[model samples]
Target: MKETYGFKTVPITLRESYSASKNGWSALLLDDKNCKEPYRSKKYDIEIVDRVGGGDSFASGLIYGLLEKQNTKDVLEFAVAASCLKHSIPGDFNLVSIDEVEKLVKSGGSGRVER
Candidate 1:
């Protein structure tokens, strides 16, 4: 598609797996020129509190990251982390702020409460 349509990049989200206590999520970012291999996020193990709106949260995070002019890798990580955090909240909407998502990304989803 990049060759035929002159596309530069494409982003894809994957629901890697799910178990009784945890759900896994990943993201793949393909950029034709800069990235030789697809940029991938580390598998995030999210404790599931609600299943609804996870995908929406990911999409929203991606869009928000892009709008905020974050780097490609940071954007992907932020999106996955945001979606992972969404699973821990008991609602259809993702209520996490960018700071919270950034904290998750930095802390590697440790599930520790901020004091």
Candidate 2:
């Protein structure tokens, strides 16, 4: 843990895992202050359009979630969801609103435009 090395211990640790078997992405977040069992997010099956700003988007979402004072589960889910949506956008920027990311996080991400 970076906290052990005199670093900021905000989220503690976040690990992103890619599952070739499921063809999707899942994330694990560990923060003792948040939950007893490590918080895990449901897999996000997204189409990769552009990976340029995926990481930055995740960090942006994480900051927003923290600012919103969300729980550990919701924060991690929002960050991961935001990053996944970035991959589906074809540019260097993640042009998604909070509602878009929240919709994906809450609705299990169908990856389709609603009618």
Candidate 3:
């Protein structure tokens, strides 16, 4: 499909099994045809306050990153981080700002309280 469509990369979100400490989620990025390995984002530790709108948040973040001209890896990271954060908030809307999502991405989704 990628070859037929001439896509540069494809990003997929995987919902991992829950562990004793946290629920895990990851994003896989497949690049060009000759690429041997896909770039994988770090597993995000999700508390999962609400699962609704998680996918939407991820898609929105991906679009935002692409619109901002972020690199493939960065875009994947941003999307996954946004989705992770969405799981912690109640309701169907993702209320987080870009700064919050970027902070989560850079911090590796540690869930630390920011002062």
Candidate 4:
């Protein structure tokens, strides 16, 4: 994976699996510190139009947070929250605001009402 992605070394917490009959796989990235967050928030409250670009949305959010010099915790929260919000819509792109992601982060990814 590292060689393909042009990395010097593989991730220390690396994992990989394949299924001959399966078509594809899903990836869920979590920070050990953020384990308290839910695996998946309420779906009835969300309307997912597309789920294709969620991964890219997450990466972009993480990168943006990191570039802003946000703390590791904030970065992870923003990234995951952005990814989650992306699921509420269709397509590969999630049109979300950084503030929205941060709001979800502040609420612990519950998608609760913001004060």
RMSD of each: 2.7, 3.7, 3.1, 8.4
**For candidate 1, lDDT tens digit of each residue in 9-115?**
77788774667767567888776644667889867766688979988998888888766744677777887888888888888998877788888889865654242
Of 1 and 2, the candidate ranking higher by lDDT: 1
Every model's TM-score: 0.79, 0.76, 0.81, 0.55
Clashing residue pairs found in predicted model 4: 49-89, 49-90, 50-89, 50-90, 50-91, 53-92
* Superposition TM-score, candidate 2 onto the true structure: 0.76
Candidate 1 stretches with Cα past 4 Å from truth are 1-7, 18-21, 32-36, 109-115
**Model 3 misses residue 35 by how many Å?**
7.0
lDDT of 2 by residue, 12-55 (tens): 32434354222365566665657656677766666567777977
**lDDT, candidates in the order shown:** 0.76, 0.68, 0.77, 0.51
| Ranking of predictions according to lDDT | 3, 1, 2, 4
How far is 28's C-alpha from truth in model 2 (Å)?
1.6
Model 2 local distance difference test score? 0.68
Clashing residue pairs found in predicted model 1: none
Q: Considering summed lDDT, which 10 consecutive residues are worst modelled in model 2?
A: 13-22
Error of 2 at 72 (Å): 0.4
Residue 58 of model 1 has an lDDT of 87
By TM-score rank, best first, the candidates go 3, 1, 2, 4
